[model samples]
Target: MTLKATKTWFLRLLPVVLFFICYYCSQIYFDSYGSSGKSPKTTVSLCDINSSQRKWSSLHLNTSRHPELFLKLEDFFWREHLSNHSLPYGIKGSELLLLKVLAVVTSYSMPGNVESSLDCRTCVVIGNSFTVKNSSLGEIINKYNVVIRLNDAPVRGFEEDVGNKTTLRLFYPESASYNPGKHNDPDTLLVLVPFKQQDLLWLKEILYNEKRVRKGFWKPPPQIWLGRFSQIRVLDPYFLHLTASNLLKIPLNPRRQQKPVHPTTGILAVFVALNYCDVVHLAGFGYPENRNQQQPIHYYGQDTMKSMKNSFHDLNLEARVLKRLEEQGVILHLHS
Candidate 1:
C-alpha cells in the first residue's frame, strides 16, 4: 500500500497497455497502408457502347421463349415481379415500372452493326461506402449509361448523390432480396445473384409459383416487366455461385486457372453494363481512412475495419481487372 506497491502494479499494467496499442496499430497499418511487393494493375475503362435509341415494341414484344425467363418463371412463382410499384424507390412498384420502360427502350434500340458492338461499354457501379464522401465523384460516374446500385446507400443523404439512371439491383434469394420500402424498385432489374447452388434452386422455385407469379399459368406477356424481373438475365448463373477466391484465379487450388474470378454481384452488374453500354465509371469505393472523425457514413454501414478486412482482397482484384481493361484501351479510368 505504498510507493513500491504502486510501482509494481504500474509495471504489470504497462506491458498489457503496450500489447493493446500494438494490436490496434497493426490493424490500422494493414487497413490504411498500401500493400507492397505486389504491383497494382492500373485502373482503366473496359468498353465503350455509344448511347442511342431504337423502336420499343419490336425490341420488347417477342420475349415469350427466352430460356432464362421460362426457367425462372417455372421457379419463383413471380411473386416479386407481379407486385411492382411506380415509385422511384421501394422494391415492388413504380421503380419497376420505370425499369420496364428503360428495358423496353433499350431492347427497341438495337446496337448498330459495328466493331464497337463487341467492345464492353461504360457502366457505373454504386456502393454505399463512405470513401466517395465529399470527393465529388458522382458527376464523373454518372457519365455511364447504366448505373448499378446495391442496398439503400442514399445519394442525397451522402455526399455523392446517387444518380437517376439506376439500371439494376444485384439481389440474392434469401436475406439479400429487395426490402419493401428501402428505396428500391421493381423496374430495377432484379438480378438474383446466388452465392450457392441451393440459392439458385430457391430462386427457380419462386419464379414458378403460380399464385405468386402474375401470369405464370402461361408464358409471361411481352413488354411486361414481370417476366424479365423474375427471369435471370445477367451473366452465367453458376458464376455467381463462386466466391472471389475461386473466380479471380487466386490460389485456392494449385492446378486451377490463375486468371481472376468474375466480379461479385455488384461488380458483375457494372461489367454487364460495360458489356452492353459504352462508358463505365466507379464510385463510393475504398475507405476515407478518417471515417470515424467525419460524419456518420459507412463503406457499407458495417464496421469499417471489419468490412475492409473482408473486402480488401476483392477490391484489389477488381482494381487489377480495371487496370488491365485500361491497358487494353477498353475504356477510360477517371480518378476524382
Candidate 2:
C-alpha cells in the first residue's frame, strides 16, 4: 500500500477511537460520583413511571378524604428552602444526604392491574396494641393485598394473631428489627420514617456501610442492619406532615413553653395506606378505655399506658381521629 493511503486510513479511524475513549471515561466518573454530586435528573422520571397508575375512587376524590402520600424525588431539592420547623416530618439541612439515600433505595408504587376490579386493592395496617394478642386474625390479615406492620413487631411466635405476610414494615432506625428475616418476609419492603437528621445519616451509613454513628438517637440503633439495600425505602415525610398538621391539628413547631406533638407510627401508617390502597383496615389500634387499669400497651411487650405520659404523641386525639374515620367508613376497624 502507498504511504499516502495508510495516512488516509488512520485519519478515518481517529474520530471513532476518540469517541470510545470519551464514553468509557464518562461512565466511570458518573458511577463513582453520581450520588454524592448533584442529584440525578432520572429520579423524577423514575417516579413518574408509576406515580399515577391508579385513579382514586369517588370516595377518595373528596377533597377532605385524600392527602398527597409519597414524596417524589423532586421534593428533596426543590422544596429544601421551605421553612420546616417540624424537623422530623420535613427536610431542611439534610436534603443532599437524603438524595444520596434515595439514589440507592427503591421507589415504592402499587403493582399494576392484576385484579379485574380496579377498586380491589386492600390493605391492613397492623398496630402493636395488646388487644390483638388472642385475636386469631392471622388468616384474615394475610388475605389483604398489602399488610403494613409497624416498628420491630414480631410475627414468628405470634403468627396466629399477626399473620406472616408483610408487604411493608414501617420503622425508624432505633425501632428496626434485629432479626428482620424472622419478622418480615423475604420481599417485604422496609420503610424508614426519618424523625430527625440523624435518622437519615443512620440510613446512609447502614445502607452503604460507610461509617457508624453512635449518637443522636433516643435509643441505640442496630449497629449492623441485616436487611437488603434494595428493600429499604424512605417514607416520605409528607404523610407525617399531613397527619400532624391536617388530621391531628397539631403545631409543627410550637412555642418554647408548649410541648411538641407528632403522629405515632400507627397513625402515619394509616395515612400512607389511604393514598395507596382502595380499602384500608386497622387492627390492634386502641389504648385501654380504662387508663387506670393495668394493661400492656402492646401485644408482645409489658409496657403499660403509663409509659405514654412523656410521649410526643397524643393517644387520645389519635383515637378520636380513628373513631371518626371508622364511623365515616373511611377505614374498617377490625375487632378480634
| Candidate 1 local lDDT, 179-239, one digit each (tens) | 4223443345545453434333344444444233333222232221233433234233322
**Candidate no. 2 TM-score:** 0.76
- lDDT (C-alpha, whole model) for all candidates: 0.43, 0.76
| Residue 62, candidate 2: C-alpha displacement in angstroms | 8.4
Residue pairs in clash, model 2: none
Total clashing pairs for each candidate: 46, 0
| Model 2 CA deviation exceeding 4 Å by range | 1-75, 78-86, 106-118
Model 1 CA deviation exceeding 4 Å by range: 1-122, 137-143, 151-156, 174-181, 204-235, 238-247, 251-263, 287-300, 308-313, 333-336
Give candidate 2's root-mean-square deviation (CA, Å). Answer: 19.8
- 113 in model 1: Cα distance from truth in Å? 18
lDDT of model 2 at position 300: 93
Candidate 2 residue 32 C-alpha distance from true site, Å:
64
Score every model by TM-score.
Answer: 0.46, 0.76
